[model samples]
Every structure is written in C-alpha cells, then in structure tokens.
Target: MIEIGHTPAKRLVTIRVSGKLTSKEYDTAVPEIEQAIEQSDGKLNAVVELDDMRGWDIAALWKDLKFDARHFDDFRRIAVVGASGGEKLSSKAAGALTSADVEFFLRDQVDKAEDWAAAD
Candidate 1:
C-alpha cells in the first residue's frame, strides 16, 4: 500500500510505502502529489518513508517512472527514510525519479529527514 500526506501548510508532501505497492495506489498518490506540487508552486519538498516496502508492481513501476519524468523539475528536495542500510539503494533509486537533492536516513533519523526536507 502507498499513502500520501502533507504538512499542515501543505508545502511538504509525505509518502509512506508499505507492503507491495500497485498502480492502483499510485493512481491515488500521483494526483495527490500533483495537487501538492501545484500548490507548492512547483517547488515542493518531500519525505518518502519506506516502511515494510516489498517492492512495486510492474504497472506501478511504469507509472512511477512516467510521473518522475513528467515532474522532475517540480521537486526541490526529497528525503527517503528507510529502516536499514539495505535500503540505501532504494533511497538512491527514489532519488533518480527527480532532479531534486535527495538524502537517505535510517528510521531513527526520520526527524532529521523531515527537518531537512521541510527547509527552504
């Protein structure tokens, strides 16, 4: 499953991916992010929390790639928080989805990730 949220002021997007993600999830997520991006005036920052992420479905993978290619410039920064060093590659992979500055942090460091992602 994939869940999308935002800061109270709606300037920052927060994404949580758990279990296996499917195109259906992205179906909902993409629009929400797009709205947030538009609301942010094309310079949104995001924090993606990969919790119990198994991986993405083939269709979700394709959808994600397309979204990234379309909105790479809409992002200002991305912070991918994972639970372990094994997720470093996943974080890097997520970063490849945009031109924004991306960082990886362990679960314990999520506060730092959110702080960095929320900054200007």
Candidate 2:
C-alpha cells in the first residue's frame, strides 16, 4: 500500500509504503508525484518510506526508472526510508537510486531522513 502526503505549499511530496509494492502502487502514486513537482514549479522534495514494505514486483522496477527519467532534476532531493541490513530489498533500492539524487536511510532514521529532505 502507498499513501501520499503533500506539504502545505505543495513543494514536498512524501510517499509512505507498506507491504508489497506492485504496478498498482506505482499507478496510484506517480500522478501525485507529478502533480507535486508541477505545483512546486519543478522543485520538489520527495520522501519515500518503505519501512513496512515486503518487496516489489518486476514491472514496478520499470516504473521507478520512468520516474527517475522524468523527475531526476525536478525532484531535487529525495529521502529514502527503510534501506538497511543489506537485504535484497535494500540492495535493489540502492541500485535503483544510483541514477537519482536521493538520501538513503534506515527505517529507524526517520528524523535524519526528514532533516535531509528539508535541507537546502
């Protein structure tokens, strides 16, 4: 499951993920991300939390790539939650984020992640 929360000024978009992620999750969240970026005048802070996420589907990988291609620059800073212990999920996230401008964090580091996301 995924949920999107936009900042008051709509300059930031935070996506919280729980359980397994599928194409449906991407479908639901991508539009919100796009809208936030547009509303923020091409500047955005994207916070992604996958603390409770089990895993992702194959097609979801392509969706991530598509997102990166479209918002690599618009989404200037990204806070990635729940990548730790060198798990497969974490490894996959690390790989996917190679082309993105994201600050990675463990599940327990929400405060630090938010600090990074809010940094200039």
Candidate 3:
C-alpha cells in the first residue's frame, strides 16, 4: 500500500509505501503526484520515502515504466529513502525514470537531499 502526504503550499509531496505495492497501489499514487505537479506548474519537488516498504508487484513495475515514459518531466527532483535491499532495488528502478535535466538523489543524506530538492 502507498500513502501519499502533501506539504502545505503544495511545494512538496511525500509518498510512503508500506507492504507490497501492486499496480493498483501504483495507479493510486499518480493522482497525488499529478496534483503536486499541477500545483507546482510542472516543475515539482517530490520525496519518495520507503520505510517498512516491501517488494513491488510486477504490474507495478510496468505501471512505473509507463508513467516514466509519458510524464518524464513532471518531476524536478526525486529523493528516495530506503533501508532494505528491496528499497535499494526500488531506488535503482528509478534510474530509467530520471532524465538528463532531472536531479535524482538517494535518500541517505537527508539534509543534502532536502537542499537539492529545494533548489530553484
């Protein structure tokens, strides 16, 4: 399951994933991110925090691929926080989603990640 939380002023969005993530859960994630993108006028900042998050369903991977293929520029920066091997794998999966212009940072350094995400 994925739980989405938005910061005030619509400047930042955080996605928390717990348990196995299926395509359905992934599908549910889009609207929140899309809304955050819209609020940020296309160049949005986001944090994908994975705590107690398990592996992803095959369909979720497909959904992620499609999402990246279509809305590649919506994200300005993506910070992934994970502690487990599955989280590491999940973070790597985002490589395909990143573009030359997009900044992708691992979630290890919280302060640095926040500073990077907050950059104009």
Candidate 4:
C-alpha cells in the first residue's frame, strides 16, 4: 500500500509505502505525482518513506518503469527513507536512471530526508 501527501512546501511530495505495492496503487499514486509536477511547472521533489515495504508487484514494477521513463527529467530531487539493504540499491538505480539527485536516509532520519527533498 502507499499513501501520498505534500509537504508544507508544495513543491515537495511525500509517499509512504508499506507491504507489497500493487499496480492499482501505482496507477493511483503516479498520477498524483504527475499532477504535482504539472502544478510545479514541470519539476518537483519527492520523498519516499518505506515502512516494511517488501517490494512491488510485477505489474506495479512495470508501471513504475514507465512512469520513470516518462518523467525522467521532471524531478529535481528524490529522497528515499528506509533501513532495508535494497533501499540503497534502489536509490542508486534511480540516480542512474534519472536526472534527479537521489539520496537515501535511515528510517530515523525521515525529517532530514523531507528537508533535503524540500531544499532549494
């Protein structure tokens, strides 16, 4: 499952992920991010908080790749908050696949992650 919200600074979007993410969730969440990008005039920052998120479903993974390909340059920064080993690898992959600056934070440092994502 996933929950999407915005920071006080509207240009920053926050996504909380838990359990196995489904394609339905991606279908719902990606559009919210797209809207944020549109409202921000093509660029935005994002902070993804992972809480016991095992991984994505195959269909969700496909949706994720399409979204990333379509909006590769629409993100300014992406902060991933998690403690799992895969989180670091995912962050590196994201950095390599997109122009956004990607950073990983331990679960306790979510505040820092949010601040970094919202930074100017």
Candidate 5:
C-alpha cells in the first residue's frame, strides 16, 4: 500500500509505503504528486517512509522509474525514513540521479527526518 500526504501549504509531502507496492498505487498517486509539485511552485520537499514496505511489483518498478525520470528536479530535498539497511543504501544510489538533496534516517528518527526535509 502507498499513501501520500501533503502539507497545508503543499510545499512538503509525506509518502508512506507499506506492505507491497503495485502499479495501481502509482496510477492513483502520480497525478496527486504532480499536483502537489505544482501547488508548491514546482519544487517540493518529501519524507518517504519505507519501514513497513515489503517490496514493489515489477510493473510498479517501471512506473516508479518513469516518475523519477520525469520529476528528478521537482523535489528540493528528500528524506527517506526507514529501518531497512538496504533501502538506505539504495536511496543513496538514487540520489546520484536526481537534483534533490537526499538523506536517510532510521524510522526512529522521523522527527529529525521531517525537520531536515522541511528546511529550505
């Protein structure tokens, strides 16, 4: 499952991912995400929690890659909060492909993660 939350100002978004992610979720979320970016004046900050996420479907992977490619510069910063050691590493690798500054935090450090993401 995937849930997306936007701050009242729409300058920041929280993406909560749990269980398994499917292409259906992306189909529903991508438009909302684009709207959020627009509302935020083209760039947004994000906090993505993957602590409860199991994995992604193959089709979802393709959708995600497309989104990333299209919106690489739409994010100002991304704080990835999760407990998975592997995800932390993967986020670092992904950061290389985007203009956004990316950081990783343990799930326990959510407050700090949010603070980092919220900073201008």
Candidate 6:
C-alpha cells in the first residue's frame, strides 16, 4: 500500500509505502504527484518513507522507472527514510538517477527528513 500527503503550498510531498507495492498503487499515487509538480511549476520536494515495504512487483518497478525518468528534474530534494541497509543503498541508487539532492535517513530520523524536504 502507498499513502501520499501534500502540503497546501504544493512545495513538498510525503509518500509512505507499506507492504508490497503494485502497479495499482502507483497508478493512484503518481498522478497526484505529477499534479503537485504541475501546480508548483516544477519546484517540489519529496520525502519517501518505506515502512515494512517488502518490495515492488515487476509492473510497479516499471512504473517507478518511468516516473523517475519523466520527473528527473522535477524535485529539488528527495529524502528517503527507511530501516534497512538495502533501503539506504536504494536511496543512493536513486540519487544517481535524478538531479535532486537525495538523502537517506534512518527510520528514527524521519522528522529530520521531513525538515530537510520542507526547507527552502
């Protein structure tokens, strides 16, 4: 499952992922994000929290890649909060794929991640 929250200012978006992610969830989540970016005229930040998320299905992974490629320059900062080493590694890999300044926070530092993502 995936949950998304956005500020009224539309400058920052928060995404939480739990359990297994499927294309269905991405279909629901991605459009809101894209709309947020459009409303912001391209300046946006993201904080993604991976909570007990096992992984993505193949179709979901494809959607992820496509979204990343399409919005490679859309985000100003991206903070990924997770509890596992693999998640940290995935954060680094994501940094390499986009222009955003990407950072990884331990699950305990989610507050810090939110602060960073919301910073000017």
The model with the greatest lDDT is 6
Query: Candidate 5, which ten residues in sequence have the lowest lDDT sum?
Result: 1-10
TM-score of each: 0.92, 0.78, 0.76, 0.93, 0.94, 0.95
Q: Best by TM-score, which number?
A: 6
Better of 3 and 6 by TM-score: 6
Predictions in order: lDDT: 0.86, 0.74, 0.70, 0.87, 0.89, 0.91
Count of steric clashes across candidates, in order: 0, 0, 0, 0, 0, 0
Ranking by TM-score: 6, 5, 4, 1, 2, 3
Off by over 4 Å in 4: 8-10
* Whole-structure CA lDDT of model 2: 0.74
Report the C-alpha lDDT of model 1 over 2-119, residue by residue, as the tens digit.
Answer: 8888774637999999999998988988998898888885589999999989888999999988998999888888988888777888778777778899999888898899999988
Task: Choose 5 or 6, whichever is better by TM-score.
Answer: 6
RMSD in angstroms, all models? 1.4, 2.9, 2.9, 1.3, 1.2, 1.2
lDDT per residue for candidate 5 within 22-109, as digits (tens), equals 9999899889888889889668999999967888999999989889999989999999998878989988988986899999999999
Model 6, span 3-89: residue lDDT tens: 988884738899999999999999999999898888774579999999999999999999999998998898999999999999999
Candidate 3's TM-score: 0.76
| Backbone collision tally, model 5 | 0
Stretches of candidate 2 above 4 Å error? 8-10, 87-100
- Tens-place lDDT digits, model 4, residues 38-120: 87845799998989998889999998988889988989989999997788888888797789999999999998998888888
TM-score of 2: 0.78
User: Deviation in angstroms for 60 in model 1?
Assistant: 0.3
Q: What is the C-alpha lDDT profile of model 3 across 1-120, one tens digit per residue?
A: 888877636466777777888998888788877777677755677677766776788999788788788778676677776666666666676766765133444556655655666567
